[model samples]
Target: MTLHIYNTLTREKEVFKPINPENVGMYVCGPTVYDFAHIGNARPVIVFDVLYRLLKTLYPKVTYVRNITDVDDKINAKARETGEDIRTITERTAAMFHQDMAALNAGNPDIEPRATEHIAEMIDMIERLIENGNAYEADGHVLFNVPSMPNYGALSRRNMDDMIAGARVEVASYKKDPADFVLWKPSDEDTPGWDSPWGRGRPGWHIECSAMSRKYLGDTFDIHGGGHDLVFPHHENEIAQSCCANKTDKYATYWMHNGHLMVEGEKMSKSLGNFFTVHELLEEVPGEALRFYMLSAQYRSPFDFTKEGVREAKATLDRFYTALRQHADIEADDVAAPDHFVAALKDDLNTPLAISILHELLSAFNKAPSPQTKGHLLACADILGILQQDVEGWFTQNTAADATEVDADQIMGMIEERKNAKANKDFATADKIRDDLDAMGIVLEDGPGGTTWKLK
Candidate 1:
């Protein structure tokens, strides 16, 4: 079946039709390099990465552009709070974001433009908005004229009053209307700035995406995606500025948004001690396990992340990896995934449904291990971006419970002693050795190949 995506702008699932059949363009809003990327920030990265992979299979070329906002108020505040150079802070945080995302197996976008690098493009777009009478300069700031665009809130479907009430609308006397948002603002000597038509200033948060997306993906693109939280002032303003500046009715053909993520049945907050940075979580859990847990729920549903849920995901992967290891000797044929499996993903990226199908495939493979079955299992897992690691490595890797160092040699020596005791018919010594290892949180699995041990 062809792909069907639930377009947030239309509020309906529509069959995806590419503007250019040979190539597809997609733009996703990336992170602002102020601090380590939180777990909440990872949902869209994984969600869109799935779409990117699926698109690659369907189309010949897909240009995925995810921008990095290196010059934001948060970054500025971080620099001030720590008394570090702004460049130093942004570069360091952006590097960490890349490192953390790579650990999650998220392939880098085809084009990752930084906001600071595209300052000239932002200025050019703001200039066009002003020339087109959709923006105006006031008190050294350039602000988008919300009233100029008749359908300013079309994408968000929120009225002017509701938008103002919902968003943290800045109230400045220079603004013509309360809904009017800044396109550019003057930066002081201490702040990062670039020369522009207005003054030496930095681009506003919303305009940075618009300018960067347009430069890389043209005035319009096939798909634009981000978290659902950005539907408000951020995306709405983008639609207004982009359509007005480019003189187009549509900025992007399709808009996809992943749902909000919560941690342990509540909003993730530092004060509550549930806010997790991907960096710190990597210290305890495997990144692939985190990715699998994130995909356990459908992309558009509110996700409640729990430590137990991560453990469950890891256990599930362990099962799949065990099956793969059992059939490691088979020379499998390269094959396409089952039609039903691919169909599940095409239906609005129903990852939970797709994953359930994966379990069936695993069961089928276990019941009858063959070249085609193993190949089919691997193909389906590839679409979900899992099961690519070394099977032996997966079983040997340390889980959250086994984050502390353990003496593998000592454990193996005890296992050898247990084997000798079993061979010599000393049942008491064998049981004692098993009990001692179990007390140490070591689980033993016996197969025809021999005894294997892993942390419980």
Candidate 2:
């Protein structure tokens, strides 16, 4: 099947033709570690992760690069507010990011570069941009010359007048134009700094990505992805710096962006009391359910997150798990996924359509409990990064926090006792144990494999 992607650059859905078919490269902008990653931050992580998984399956070699912005002003401010060392704050926050993404079943990128490690590259690119007459250094601050690139607003399609009128970006006293963005800025003695020709300063947020992407994926790569919000000055500035410095019109061949996330038909905000972190949501629903919920909508559509939505997602997964439970004795066929499932994903990563295919596969598995159907069902789940855990484990997992409640082990022990009673022809005792378990909120299913239980 021919792969297709909706390019944010051209504003159209086009067939995906990689620059180098032998070596496909994709770069996704990662989190700037200052605090726990909220639900909005998770959208692109999960979206591009599915894309990464798809690329790996189709290509012989794929390099996925995601950079960590560990050297940001937010990290410095967080250190000051918490009275913790800067390194301590960034290190802890980055580790938590990895943990949270892992819980959501996101695989590690092939190249996970950090901004602090790529400072030299950033400095080199800044110098190149200066030589190419695309940037200027003023007042110990280096800024990209927006007017230098005639196609500055091409990606976002905004004229200079429109940007100046609608833009809320700060205009510094030293900037030649209000549209010019920072490449490097002076760092206070208390903050992290790297000595450069411009004096003690740190690279700007835009330059960090430009340098890192060039270092890992060459001056130009196949695909660049991130949240839809980064299309403005962040990605636009990266395009200017990288293309100007590298002497190329095209930096990344394809631009893919996931849409924004909302909560219950409104934008999520801490002040609005609708704010939620991925870590907090994981406490209520399994990470698998959250991942599934995010994929229910296409990548480019605004997703309205609701508690009822997550619960429904969890219940839907329960249906898939129950199908597998009924056929536990038959191992999942280790084979390729159905063609229709792959086709849906290839068509601009239409996950809602892909998930619909998944349900069809589930129905097929329910109709015929054979290895081929089971394998197709599971192989498709692998592409979506769901239903990876054991079927028995899915039913046994206890997320409800009530110390007084019976655990999975005790419930299983009761099942085993009932099995023994039935074997000894003590039908009355076996029925009583089943009744007791039901009263404790455990629903038992007797299948070809054995008795499995799920909480009501």
Candidate 3:
């Protein structure tokens, strides 16, 4: 199948033909790792994750590289605020990021490089830029000469004049042009620093991705992806530095960017009091529901995340799980994802259309009489990364019980009574008990061993 992606550079959907069909390389800019990742931050993580999965399916081998920005100004600020060591903050936050993304079922990348670990590589790239007259040292800093790369604004489609007007360019005496961005800047005694040709300094934000991507994925890769916010100065600088340093016409064959996310109808911001961390939201909603809600919209469209929207997504997943539970005897066969679903995903990762196809499959599975129908439903769901939980487990894991309120014996007695009602063909009574439990937002699932419950 030919996969097509919307190349941000061209501003059009183009067929994705990898440079080397045998091996595909993809690079995505990762988080700064100073704090918990918000739902907005998760958009790119999950969006690119789907593309990574799709690419692996289509190619013989796919190397997906996502970097960890452990060294940043943000890290410094966080350290000062918490009175903790910078490394400790970065380590803890990175671990939390891994846990949160994993909970959303986003698979790990093949190569996860850290910026601090690749300082040598970044310095080497900077040296090459300096040798090529694309960079210069001034005020103990190395800055990329934006004018050296004529295609600096191609990805963002902003002219240099307009870019300079919009950007809050530091009127540094050292910079040759207002558009020139820092490749490496000197770090003070307190900040993180590493020995470089330009003295003790740290890499600029854009250089980390350029250097890490080159070190792992080579000078030119198949795809580079990130949030839309990164397109302007971050990605544009990456394009200029990589292309200029490596003497390559193309840095990445395709550039994919996911849109911004909003809370309710407004932009999510700290001042708005809607800035939600993934960790905090997980306390209220299951991570699977969050993932489902994210995939409900097309990746490029700005998503409005509302409490009601998440509740609706949870209800949708519950319906799917309920169907699977009812047909536990139905054995699904292992098969490739259906053609229509794959087609939708291949077309620039159209998750909205892909999800619609899944619903259609669900409907067909519900109406079909063949025992194989359940297997087919499951096979389709596997591609979408849902319905992997034990059908009984989903219903039993999150039930209504305050830790200090309920005794083990009481719960056991209720289960026993519910089981007796089911055995005596007293489904009315059995359902009533289930309804009573559900009123507390609890779900029950019966199995060969016994009945289990979970909070809804």
Candidate 4:
């Protein structure tokens, strides 16, 4: 089956058609780089990474661009609170974002443009908008004239009243209309600014993405993606600025958005004590487990992340790894994934269905351990970005708070003692050792290879 994506603009699952099939281009809105990315922020990253992997297989080349906004009001606020240089705070936060995302096995984009580096492009776009009469400079600030665009809320499908209320637009005296949004805002000496036609100012939040995406991926690209929350103002403003400046009716051919993410049963928040950053979660749970757990649900479905669910994800991975370990000597063939597995992903990224197919593959491989069967299992897991770790390392690695309490050497020594007891025909002593390890939250499995231990 061909690839199909749920286009937010059309509100339908349509077949994905690239403008140029030889080289597909995709742009996803990245983090603002003012603070650690929370778990809710991770949904789009993991979701799109799977789509990226699938695209690579279907096309000759795929150019993925994810930007970083280094110059923002949030970064400025953080600098003030810490009494640090704006550049210093932005650099540190950007570095942290990269490291944290890398832990999740998210591949780097082909082009990662920063907002500060693209001031020239942003200034040029704003000038074009002004010349086209889509924007005007007022009170040393350039604002997009929403009334100029007849279909201002085309993508969002909202009326002017709903758009204004939803965006909570500033009703400033300088704005020509209440729905008008900023393209460029004057920045003081303390804040980051660049020389432009209007004055020394910085690009608005929405303008940064418009200029960056156009510079990297043409005026109209294959796919533009982000969290669902961005559909109204952030993405809506981007479409307005890009189409007006470029003189094109379409900013992107396809628009995709992932669903919202919650913690347990409530919205993720620091005040609720449920907010978690990917960095902090990595310490307690394996990164692969988090990736797997996130994929367990369909990308477009609202997800309620829970601690118990994360533990189950880890245990499920253990089952797949154990099967591979039992047939360690078999050399898996390099093979493409089963057709049904790829079809599931092609159908608007049905990751939950794809993952369920993985379980069936696992069961099939266990029943008949062959190079061909193993290859099918590994190939399917590759698309999901799971089951890639070393088999033995997966079992021995420590995770969670309790897993660290015990030592690998200590567990191995006890396993050896039990082995000796069983060899001596002392069943009683062997059972006692097994019970003792069980008391300490350890599970021992005896197979033809020998007894292996893992944290329960």
Candidate 5:
């Protein structure tokens, strides 16, 4: 079955038809590089990564662009708080974001343009908006004329009146309407700014994506994705600026958004002390386990992250690995992924259902007697990016409950003794040692490479 995406703009699930059959271009809004990315920021990263993978399989070329917002107020504040240069702060935080996202198995985008680097493009787009009468310059600031874009509230499905009330537009005297959003704002000598037609100023938050995406992927791309929070004024303003500047009716064909993440069944907030950064969570849990837990639910549904939830996801992965280890000698065919699995994923990326299909495939593989069938099972697991680690390495590196106090030499010595006991036909002693280790949450695997262990 062909892929079907639920386009937020159309308010319906439509078949995904790329502008060019040979290539697909997708753009996702990246994080503002002021602080470490939290779990909430990771949802779209993983969600879009899966889409990128799927697209690569169907199309020969896919150019995925996710921008880095480096010149925002948050970055300026972070710089002031630390008494450091803005460039230093943004560079450090952006590097940390890359490390965190890599841990979650997210592939890098084809082009990662920074906002500061694309100032010229933003300025050019703003100029076109002003020339086309969709924007005006006032008091060294450029503001988009909201009323000029008749379909301003199409994507969010909000009326202009309600949007004006909810939107946080600056109440400058130059603005003709309250709904008018800023395209460019004046920046001081200390702040980051570039020379523009109106004055020396920085581009506003919304225009960067429109300008950069157009420069990299053209005026209209296949898919534009971001968090649900950006659906309102941010994306709405993008639609206005891009369509007006380019003289087109549509900016992007499909608009995708992932739902918010919560912690312990409540909204994750700093005041509640529940906010978790990806770097902090990786200390206690494997990144694969986190990715698995995130995909356990639909992308459009709220995800509640808890300690118990992560543990459960890890346990589930252990089961799949256990079955594969039992039939390690199996050599299966390199077949394509099952049609059922593809169908589920193609339906707006229904990963929960696709994962269920994986479980079924695992069960079938466990029941198969031939070594070749087992190999095909493993191949399928590899496509999902699970069961790729050395089975022995998974247990040894991941199983330690209190890794701080454990000595590596001591654990290896125990495993050596267990091997000697089994070789000497001392079944009773070997069983006792295995049971003792199991009680400590250590699992032993006896294989051709001798005995290996992992934390339970």
Candidate 6:
């Protein structure tokens, strides 16, 4: 089956055909490094990560570019408000972003370009826009002319009235039109600035992505992705600037957007106390569990992240790992993922359906454990980027349980003692040991295969 993606540009599921099959290019707008990434920020990171893995499996070469917005007014404002150095804030926050995404099993992009590093490219693109009459400079600032591009709001489908209403709050006296956005703005002595034709000023947010993507993926590319909230001003502006400067009818061939996320049916916000960073959640549940839980819903649908849902996801992974534990002795044969599973993923990354197929594989393996069945089960999980941890590690190295508080090796010793006592027909000692293990939240199971223990 041909892979289909729900393109935000076309507002429909379209069959994905890269401009060049030998190499596939995908660019996703990344975080502006001013603060910790919230759960909302993680949605696109994970959604695209799954897509990235899928692309790698299909194409011989895949170049995934996710840029970092290191130079922004928000970062400067954060420095000013906190009295922290701008470099320190961006460096610290960027490091945290990488750590958090790594925990989610999101691979580092093939090319991670920084906005600050591409200042020259941004200036070049801005200059091209000026020569093309799509942008004009006034009052130490260069702003893109909203009226210059007739189809400016095509992607967002916002008319001039809508754009005016949305952009009214940020209107500047130097702007020719209310909808015109900053391509370059003057930075004060205290703020981070780069020397440009517009004097000592930093590049605007939308222009950063355009310039960076052009430098890496060329003027036109395969796919551009980000969160649904960015469909308006941010993405819309990028399209106008890039297409106008490059003299192309299209900027990106396809656009992909993941829906917003809510916390327990409420909007996730710091004000409501529901905002959670990935690091904070990692303290409560395994990263794999959180990753699995996020894919429970389709990428385009809004997700309600609940504490209970995460716990259930963790338990579900435990069951899958238990099947692996039971068949550990069997040498799994190398096998391809099931066609049905691949078909599910290809159908717009229908992970909920794909996960159902995984459960079917799990159920089949539980009934009859064999090398072939085990390999097939794992192959499916590999595509989903789950169930890779060794079975013993799944039980012993869980974040839900404080490994420091309960030593897994110590619990194994107790189970061994119980086994020896039972063999000696010392029923009293065996029963006492069982009771002690139970009190410690470790449940023991005895069968023909001897004893296996798991946390309650």
In TM-score terms, candidate 6 sits at 0.96
Question: Which parts of model 1 have CA positions greater than 4 angstroms off?
Answer: 399-402, 407-414, 424-436
What's the TM for model 3?
A: 0.93
Question: Ten residues in a row with the worst lDDT in model 6?
Answer: 396-405
Residue 307 lDDT (model 1): 93
Computed on alpha carbons, the lDDT of every model, listed in order, comes to 0.91, 0.90, 0.85, 0.91, 0.85, 0.89
- What is the C-alpha lDDT profile of model 3 across 196-275, one tens digit per residue? 87789899989999999998899898999999988888898899999999999989989988898999899999998999
- Tens-place lDDT per residue, model 1, 180-204, is 9999999999989999988899999
Give TM-scores for every candidate, taking all chains together and pairing residue i with residue i.
Answer: 0.96, 0.95, 0.93, 0.95, 0.93, 0.96
Clashes per candidate (backbone, < 3 Å): 0, 0, 8, 0, 4, 0
lDDT of 5 at 87: 90
Cα lDDT of model 4 by residue, 1-456, tens digit: 999999999999999999999999999999999889899988899999999999998999999999999988998999999999988888898899999888787888999999999999999999999999999999999999998988789999999999999999988998889999998999899888888888898889999999999998989999999999999999999999999999998999999998899999999989999999998899788889999999999888899999999999988998899999889989999999999999999999999999999999898889988898899999988888888788877876666653547777888898899999999999999999999999988889889988888766
Clashing pairs in 6: none
Candidate 5, residues 1-456: lDDT per residue as tens digits? 999999999989999999997879999999999999999999899889888887887799999999999999888888888899999888999999999898787889999999999998998899899889999988888999989999889988888778987786557788888888888999998888888888888889999999999999999989999988899989988998999999998999999999988999999999999999888888788877888899899998888999899999989988887776666666566677777887888999998998898888878877864655565556555545566677755556643335545455777788788778878999888888888777766777776756767775
The weakest ten consecutive residues by lDDT in model 4 span 396-405
* lDDT by residue for model 2 (1-456), tens: 799999999999999998889889999999999999999999999999999999888989999999999999988888889899988888998999999999898899999999999999999999999999999999999998899998888888888877666556676899999988889999988989999999999999999999999999999999999998998868888898999999998999899999989999899999889999998888677888999999999999999999999999999999999888777788877889889999999999999999999999899889878898889988889999999887877776666555245577799899999999999999999999999998888888887668879876
Query: What lDDT would candidate 2 get against the real structure?
Result: 0.90
Q: Which regions in candidate 4 have their CA more than 4 angstroms from the true location?
A: 401-407, 425-441
lDDT of 6 by residue, 1-456 (tens): 999998888899999999899999999999999998888898898889989888888999999999999988889889989999988999999999999888887779999999989999999999999999999999999999989998988888878888778755386898898888999999888878989987999988999999999999998899999999999889999999999999999999999999989999999888999989988888778788889999999999999999999999999998998878877888887998888898898999999999999999899989988888889888888878898676877776646535436787788898889989989999999999999988877788776688888767
